[model samples]
Target: MRIAKVEAFWLRCPIPEAKQHRSDYGLLTAFDMTLVVITTESGLQGFGEAKAAVGSSGVCASIVSCVENELAPILIGQDARNINELWERMYNGVRDHYAIKRGRVFPILGNRGLTVSAMSGVDMALWDILGKSLNVPVVQLLGGAIRDRMEAYASGGWAGADAIGEQLLGYTAKGFKAIKMRVGVMDETVDYSIERVKAAREALGPDIKIMADAHGTFSVPEAKRFCRGVEDCNLYWMEEPISPDNKKGTAEVRAMTTIPIAAGESEFTRFNIRELIELSAVDVIQPDSAIMGGITESWRVAALAAAYQLELAPHCWGSALSFMAGVNIAFASPSAVVIEFSSGGNPMMYDLVEEQIQAVDGQILAPTDPGLGMTVNWDFVKEYKQ
Candidate 1:
């Protein structure tokens, strides 16, 4: 069918007090998400989310501007079935050009912040439309379910050492077998992270998995120190120990540490993913489906990961729409190790959707319904719309 309407809603969803978290970045503050709704000529509505982590300004407006002015005009009457073609059109439409220094050519697209974020929403909506039209779940369209249920890891917990006792107990109490906690927020030293992991391991025992996220906080040397120091903790992986773009630094950290490196949440497209893999930067790929041109590009990244023998544990940190998109990607890809479940302490996690994503005893059942397999609570979403 043909595309008829494309709309974007930007919302600033505040973190609930009970679920409030802190990290290296700062207090786990309000999150910004841009929801894209696409209405086909036949009146089918498909929803997608953009990973809209806003600054003081410009970001939310950019998301809306791109969809309304740049992309919608280009794809208004185009066939929604040509998902890839439309994706390329949108990807190529945005070009950052200037600095033409005597024969130097630079026409970049499908890379970086607002360009990819906006394109991601549109690309995702196309997949949702495609799935709804065919009456098949998005997972089926991707290649069918690879596993019966997805294993999810609880993410958060960087309040402090004093809070570790409470945090660890809370996670296990929810029956989460694996958990990831924030490090490097308190101090610039490795001592804090080492202690945090040690405490987590001590509380968790051997069977439960522990992962650490430095949030791209340390230098290469500091990362090496932290990873080696926490080696005894038997962490599942060390995430974003160094900056996301430092391929050489990441590779060096990976070489020195026995712990697996997981990154790419800050990365925007498959190109970024390719460079990371070619450099052997990470053991696991963490493509944020909402940010990286949606499920279509993430699936492409997953295929790339398979070729490199890498595991996909997608970086999930947004509304339920984005979370479910990540889940569907995990379901479809054989290389998936785990899909992050950030719903533990956040009501916004479940409030964004009408259907609940039930995770019992650390396992999540894959949704089998049509489209993205989750219904958006637009009314709730509208309440916080900017």
Candidate 2:
């Protein structure tokens, strides 16, 4: 079916004060995401989500404009099933013909950042459309699932040292066997971060897996020190210890510490992930489908992870659309053993779609519904559209 229309809306939902948590990105007050909808000529519609930032809160006006004013014109009237070709067209811009002819990228100047983010949304929607047309789930389109279900780790922990253990215990109470906690600048000191992790480990015991994320706030030395201090804790992985800009520094920290380094949620495309792999900087590659060129590119990243013997734990911290997109990738990729379940106060995660996402007994089942397996709650979208 041909694409008949493309539209984007910026949605913002405030977090209740009681559920809000502090992090290196500061206290998140609201959650924002760009919702993209693609309608086919035959009346079928698909949904996708794009992000302006890796965190929960971001101004989505630019993403919306990029999707509506910039990319939509290129997408309308194209064959909705030509997902990859459309992605190449969006990325290569006017030079799409040359890129297609040569079987290589002739990307435009806006190959990254907002342009890619916009492209991500459109790509996801196109995949959703393709899956629905075939009457199969997105994971099946990606070659079916590798397993019936995968483990899900709780992805929020921001309590201080005194309460960190209790906070982590709360996640375990929800049947999550693995949990991730925030570290780095949020703690104000490396020692405090170390103390908090140690406390969490002690409280959760050795059987439960624990992960720590610095949110790219720590320097190389600080990351090394924190790793050294928490070496005995058996962390599942240490995530984004240093900035995404410093691949060498991340590699250095990974080399110095036994803790497995995880990164890539802040990155754009498979190319960025290729660099991280080449540098040996990360043991786990976390590609957020919303930010990392959608399911098309994220599947590529998962393949790279599999070929390189690295782990795949897609960053699932946005709307239900992005989260399910990640889940589809995780199920399709053999490298992915665990998926992320946001344990924060994210309205977009729960209320943005009609479908409910839940991790049962710390495991997430493979989605059986066609497309991304979610229906947009238009009423919620109308109320939250900014």
Candidate 3:
């Protein structure tokens, strides 16, 4: 089927005051995303999400504009099933012929940032359309699932030392066996971040798997010190301890600490992930489908993780479309053992879709429904679209 139309809407849903939490990204007041819809000539439609930021809040106008003014024009009359060729066309711009002829990238100047983000949404929608056309789930299109279900970790913890344990236990009460907490600048000091993690470990005992995400706020030395202090806690992994800009510094911290380093949610494409792997900076690769180059690129990252013997835990902190996209990748990749479940007040994750995405006793079953396995809540989109 040929692509008939492409539309993008910027959706921003304000978080309820009681559900909000503070972190290195500051107190998140709203959740925002760019929703992309691709309709085929035969009346089939697919949905995808493009993110402006890794965190909960961002200005999505630019992403919407990029999809409408730039990417959509290139895609309107193309064959909807030509997903890979379309991706290269969007990336290579006018030089797509060269890339196709040479079997390598001849990317445009906008290869990395906003253009990639827009491409991510379009690529996801294309996958959704392909799966629908074949009457199969997205995971099946990715060579079927390796497991029936996958373990998930609660991905929100912002409480201070005094209340951190209780906050984490709340997630466990919901049957999550693993949990992640925020650290770094949010705590105001590296030592305080250490104390909070220690307290969480003490309260949860050794059975519960704990992870700490610094949101790329700490310096190299500070990350090293925090790792040193929490060495005894047996953290599942330490995530984004330093900025994404410093691959060497992240490698240095990883070398100094026994804690496995995890990163890549802030990155753009497989090329960025390739650098992280080459530098030996991370033990786990966490590609967010919405921010990185969508399912097409995330699957590539998962393959890299498998080849390199690294772990794959896709970052799933955005809308349900992105979260389900990550789940599909996780289920299909042998390297992916666990997926992320947001524990914060994320409206986009819950209210953006008609499906109820929840963990059952800390495990998520593989999706059997067609496409991304979610029905868009157009009413919700109408109310929230900015």
Candidate 4:
């Protein structure tokens, strides 16, 4: 069968409390989720969501435009079963051919950011279609799950110390042993970040794991200092302490501190992930399904990380669709230690799916049904559609 119609929906979901969702990047005024639906000739629908960075309206718009104007024109009429060909088409269309024209001296500035986000959504929807065509779970189609039930870290640690204390208590009470918190949002100072880490450690105690995310705000020296300061907290891992672009700087920070550095949620291809692995920039690889070309490319990343013996904690920040996509990857990979479970800030996450996955006794039970198991709540979709 052929892929017929490709639709993109932009939903600007608001955060519950305005002050609660602010991060190092900026305040998450409203979350923008771009959903992709690929309809086959037989009338089966496959759904996907783009996990754009918080407060990125332009990027979100770019994703919708890329899918509608760029990707759909090329993807529509293509064989629905030929997933590899479709991915390669999107990849080259964005990153290769369109990027470098004859007289052009340089490639496009933000093609990786804008073009790939759109491509990723399409890729996910295509995979969902593929899984549904053959009656099997996406993880099974990927050679079955290495893990039946996956463990997850509570994805919070926002606001300040007092909020963090309460949040951590709530997460642990819900049986989350590992949690991630924002570090560089409030204060750029190493001392302030350290205090946050210290407070988190004190609240969660030494047994529970605390992972701090700088969100790529700090410079090399500042990131190093912050890592060193929080080294005493015995964190499980530190995520994106510096920018993802600075490979040398990331490696230097890794050399300076014992905390395991994690990054690559912003990166979209296996080439970038391979570079991160080869450079020893990140100890744990966090590739987001929605942003990293969905299941196909994310599985490639998982293989790459496995070859290097690096940990894979699939970065999840979008709707339930993308979270389930991440879960499929987490289930299929032996090296996957934990997947991100959102808390507090993301309203779209809670409202997007029929049944949201939750942790029980510190482990999340992944979806075992056919496709990515994404049963979208279309009522919420219509209500929040931008």
Q: How do all models score by TM-score?
A: 0.93, 0.99, 0.99, 0.92
- In candidate 2, how many clashes are counted? 0
Q: Who is ahead in TM-score, 1 or 2? A: 2
List clashing residue pairs in candidate 2.
Answer: none
lDDT of 1 by residue, 1-386 (tens): 88899999887777667666655545655666788899989999888887666211124778888778877887889899998767766765543222223332243453588778888888878888888888988988988997899788887666566668578778878988888887864555689778877887887789988888888888998998898788888989998898876888999999988899998888888888889988889899988877788888899899998888898888777777777788888888889968788843454467777887777988888768888876778787778888
Off by over 4 Å in 3: none
In order of lDDT, best first, we have 3, 2, 4, 1
Per-residue alpha-carbon lDDT of candidate 2 for residues 215-243, written as tens digits (9 for 90 to 100)? 99999999999999999999999999999
lDDT of 3 by residue, 1-386 (tens): 99999999999999999999988778888999999999999999999999999999999999999999999999999999999889889999999999999999999998888789889999999999999889899999999999999999998889989999999999999999999999999999999999999999999999999999999999999999999999999999999999999999999999998999999999999999999999999999999899788899999999999999999999999999999999999999999999999989988889899999989999999989999988899999999989
* lDDT score, candidate 1: 0.79
Compared with the true structure, what per-residue lDDT tens digits does model 4 show for residues 6-47?
999988876666425666556666667899999988999899
- Model 3 deviation from native, Cα RMSD in Å: 0.7
The reply for model 2, stretches above 4 Å from the true place, is none
Q: Local distance difference test, per candidate?
A: 0.79, 0.94, 0.94, 0.80
Superior candidate under TM-score, 3 versus 4: 3
Residue 46 of model 1 has an lDDT of 89
lDDT of 4: 0.80
How much lDDT does candidate 3 score? 0.94
